[model samples]
Target: MKKSSFILMSMLLVFTMFVAGCGKSENNNASGETPKTETETPKESEAPKKDVSLRVFSTFGGTDTAREAFQAALDEFTSKNPNIKVENDTMSANDDGFRTKVNTDMTSGNEPDLLFYFVGADAKGFVDAGKVVPLNDILDSDSTWKSGFSPAALENVRQKDGNIYAVPLTGFYEGLFVNKKIFEDNKLELPTDWDKMKTAVQTLSKKGIIPLAAPFDQSHYVIEHFILSAAGSKGHNSGLADGIDPNWEKGYAAMKELYDLGAFPKDAATIDLGMASNYYGEGKAAMILEGSWAMGNWKDPAVLDNTTVIPFPAMPGGVGTGKDVIGGFGSGFYLSKSTFDNADKKDAAIALLKHMTSPAVIEKIALANGGTPAAAGVEIKGKTQTATEGFAMVANADSVNNPIDTMVAPETFSTLRAGVQAVVTGKKTPADVLKEAKDIEDANKK
Candidate 1:
């Protein structure tokens, strides 16, 4: 019996070992059949997505807070879309450096994917170069794109060729920003007409304050102001476009009155808009003849809180009433013809562009930075003092005039600047300035 029991136990142990060995063999077969590990699979998922980057050059000064806010928005966009990237290559706030960059790059075939440029001749030049893409298709295809912007905003971006080159974030109006407290303290009512404004200036000056802060160093701003005022004096609705017409007399005489009133600082000839803004912000001057951009600076804690913006004081018989605004269109992101030619980068670039200018992004940018919207229907979020005032000016304006510098041919900006300098420095009278500009324009027309 004992021998039988030992034999049975030995047999069961052998059977158990055999089953375990068989299971181990089956596992190895299954594992060895497919040798492709996760790492060994097609690398399409891991290959660093073709680095899609868009290079942008702009006229917005990088140092300005507005530029910084836009950059933040761009960063948010890139974070959400890992496949696309934007490279800000250059920023030129004023026209001089901006034009140099545009001409140099446009002629060299090294244009950026996006750029901030002028409306008339500059837009024409880009189209002639076969560079700027018409945004009509983009606008037509996307309801949000077409519906988000104001018609006035769209009009500014359209070229004579009926192509859209850019979009603007702000609708600027040339207006007077005054220290309300200062005026009320002086017992002065808000100036409603030219005579009242002139009187207000004299009264303010008597109190040892410069009546208005008008910058001379940056001729562009000064020119816009003068044009708006003159338009008001002549009753011209669109002063800039009117200036282009051969039959237009232009607003020279009205400009002369502002020049003679001693309305500006003692060294007004050398003051730039930036300096003039400082003068107004610090209360060194009672008011400033500036654009909607001025309101943006007021949001800063360093600026006075008691500021108010009003349109250029009315001219009795001028064609432009208090409602006419002087400003051009806003800017938009651009894509290089070369980038759009590439397959992967093109898809990524367009995707990112759409994302950045989407309703959400536009509202975010405008609200965060005290700016207006280039995208339609997106309400501005944050109400900075200046941005709010700026929008009011736009809403109240009956017409908008393009900047004279933007309308003219190349080098004409320089000529206009020089003429402005002559007037502010007392070297050339207002008539001389107007005649010089007319001569330049006439030559260009011929």
Candidate 2:
């Protein structure tokens, strides 16, 4: 099948996205600082061997599947560069505080030497604020490192200004994970479309099994898929700058429709993502909304054996095709501006970034977490069946969209999330929620 590039990605093959490729800017001087000349340039090969400590912050800690692989990569870097010490500062991506901590540190002048975060809207603030240095020159200067990345991976991460700020390691795709065994036992069909999905939810819920294991607070995946399922790719990427799409309301309405039918866990109102995932991992939930990175976290052999992924079905009143997916090269590591200018640490930070994102390390992390490796021709080995099938799903998608959060203001996305409970419980209409979210989006642009 010919894989179409989604809003922010132009994927090459299976399990990837085709983000809209923006024209690369002609000028390379947008980043505030001037490039270092040959003599003063920091190269991994020319770094002086001396004691230097660097802190790197990311979402690679706690129960993250890539935690050990990431640390091992760092350990290898630190071992080779014995003079450099790396403080592995990390937070779980599931936590509400993850973005808050990153923003706080970036704005407070306490930015880490290396930051692993989202590539788009989330990084826009810091990137525009000049907290991080654009790596275009550095990447160009090193032919070996520059050639290691897939051209599309690098291109999709380019900021609106046409400069590449974040260096990508892996891309990702999100899907609806179905437990085949449960469906079989209940004599139900896979939720390939809205009617089938509702049937499964009603059947599973009647049998006392959670139809969909999702939390209200960290409803990232839920919101993403629902919106994509309702609005389709073009509408999903059509940020609120123009106006709210009517299909957007249908997304929320579909969520309420599922909620009224007992799709979510009873304690979903208060449980966090971890708890919701725990329910799915323990085999108490028949289905879940998660990304490829979740493959390692679901430990039950039975669950793993029965697992398969599909794009969330389009809702009844929405324009989305059931084949649309949510995914892309969403995030990567950034070299802090402060670190780049510090002569003592410049070489160390750049070297570490190079080493961490090297093709070999990218393969390892991708294997561990089921992320699509960003390095061209770097094949991931021993991926689970679910992961492999998810690749096929992405390759077959009508449109693979970036998460709605990336397209909208953070506050606007937050408002949409906040309205889920209110909408599901009959306290608010879907139109009201969309209006409130659109208002917030408009205000944020001011």
Candidate 3:
């Protein structure tokens, strides 16, 4: 009996030992200290994504519709990309010091991850400095995005080296914004030729109405339109790189003729662009020379209802036939090479740029500003008469040239503006202005 009792005790001890060992193994697996099978799931906290932040800069501020549209698109981007944060730094494009600020930041190596600025000669400095990233590879890799841009828009941003540094948003064209109703009310003909323009100016001036809202203080717009009208695209572009071409003399003379005929407001010599726009918007003036982008400022219903755009009338004996336009891809976005070099931020920055310049966003901007869209297949819905006329003028233009202010060096542009003002005010003749411009250009070359 004693032997049997001992055997039972031994068996029970063994069984208890086996069960305890099994429990230890199960605990080890649950504690995650042991290797698991391939079927095991990953924890939610494992391999978390790192958050990224980007700096974006632009010249879209104030109550401008472009600003609002850009903000909306940026908000949407942030919502979609919760892992990425964008810091927007904006300023007024109309600010005289805008270019100075941009250049300072860029030169100081404090550039934003993305930038909105003028293309062509204005962007050439950054591109040459290797500060801007060439977008050819990115655009080529993404066929959808590449196909959305118009060829002409792409060409405008393409550099002489065949590299594209920016993505165009909205292109612009310079023309005369006319009050059709005002002309009809006065029994005046639309200014289709130099003679008709003179007739219209005389009739309007005699009735105490300002025929054209001319602002000499900020006369770049006037100079651009007059030069393109007189010199044509080929003549203007050829002369802009060098000093003032002889063709520019014709442009200066044309502006002087208009000034002598009393086509401008009495205070035109002192007023700025804003004042000139107000003069036209308030129905005090029959016409204003402005770009397509200015359409947003004319929000007065009366002004909107009466306004239509037309090319400037042909200058007498000018090289241009009055069909040449002064405009192209005036502004676009530039990507920073430093931002794109970071392994983590590169993909996100590219994605953000693509999203910002997407077809939907571009269309929204165009509609809000009533400007020409750079993206292809973006139909301007609920078109204004002004926009319709502007588009028609662009489509029918014989050739499009960049504004002189955009093509020339900053000093030369300033000199040209002041010279044109002098000519318009009769303080200097066209020949005198051209000689002074040539001197400045020669000095700049040296």
Candidate 4:
């Protein structure tokens, strides 16, 4: 959406939401509309229910925290509308294969009725192909539903075309998650700055503890935090369409510096994000660079009890304030164009979409995942200490940014990710790797 339009919409929602006291009437339909029961009578017996089946693809699988809550939401919708049967299709999205699968399915004409995916360049393929419907008219048709969303959240997901094709559930933020108990036990100070971080890395590695639990292959968080902290918001957000920023070189250099300090696992190149997370969760590592959605997945009570998130400390000569963060409403639900055009599935799909993105469901999912709720005035109760610290970190941050992957083409990003191992292992200089990535970016633009 245009900047002016986003601002105007934000102002309108803020006024209306304040008038509504940041909440809607209780017992309303999942879509935020009050039930029409006062005027309509039961007619279940008058006609057979038109049965409809929907497939919802999301990342709420394995230890995603929101898995159970999402399934419960599906169950509730099924019970309320017996005619609609929802297949809760889910997958762990900690690896590149998930994106491959999503792209393949979307391109193969096997798109789900409702797909939960990223918002920016990651979505450009199916979006440009017209495989999904822009949700502007749909959201406008239902003021209650649109009103339930925070304007900023919707604004974050709006495409460059000045249209919204996705309805967000919960937003997220990423930072360095520390195991406080481990630090205390080792008589080490928390790595709130570069000096302290280096001390922790050296000391922890000497003690045979993983200083930073990160995988070289699935290094999304590592790449994101390092670049944002080193390059600051402006340089980081500057897409490769122009050229390489020198600060970006500093980011990779910092990663190499960490590698020399034994900051990564011995098998970092082989492990995936899950195993990296496992090392941190099992208290085998002092810290892990991760996102808010990852907080609830750690089952170790000791680790969970002592964990706190901090922005990756700013590096020497870097312009970042040491408080710049990475995150926002990065992902959301999209209604498939085929589903909308299907006369037999249109209403059912829309109803299911509304029910899933409802404030009530968003709240439940946020409570479970500790993500920033997209629904206006919806508060998360029973948030863990880690989540509380995360919120405070974001609230005090100088800037919040989306991850770098969202700004560039998929293949270009893949090249960047593939560069991490080579950069750290001395096989490639940061400049060389970035030049290769820039070449790929240039080709993609053509």
C-alpha lDDT score of every prediction, in listed order:
0.65, 0.88, 0.83, 0.91
Worst 10 residues of 2 by lDDT: 17-26
State which candidate, 2 or 4, has the greater lDDT.
Answer: 4
* Candidate 4 residue lDDT tens string, 1-446: 89999999999998998768535555355567856556887666676778899999998887788899999999999999998889988888775677988999999999999999999999998999999999999999999999999999999999989999989999999999999988998999888889999999999999999999999988888888888888899988886866898988999999999999999999999999999999999999999999998877799898999999999999997887799999899999999999999998999999989988999999999999999999999976437888988988988999999999899998988888899999999999999999999999898878
> Per lDDT, what order, best first?
4, 2, 3, 1
Score every model by TM-score.
Answer: 0.79, 0.88, 0.88, 0.89
Model 2 C-alpha lDDT per residue in residues 323-418, reported as the tens digit of each score: 999888999999999999999999989989999999999999999899988998897643788898998998888887888888777898898888
> After aligning candidate 4 to the native by TM-score, how far in Å is the CA of 62 from where it should be?
2.2
- Stretches of candidate 4 above 4 Å error? 1-45
Residue 302 accuracy (lDDT) in model 2: 96
Error of 1 at 368 (Å): 3.7
The 10-residue segment of model 3 with minimum total lDDT is 238-247
How big is the RMSD of model 2?
Answer: 22.4
Q: All candidates: CA RMSD in angstroms? A: 6.7, 22.4, 4.0, 19.2
Over the stretch 102-195, how does candidate 1's per-residue lDDT look in tens digits? 7888779888776655666555566677786777887789876678677767877777678776655554456677788778889888776778
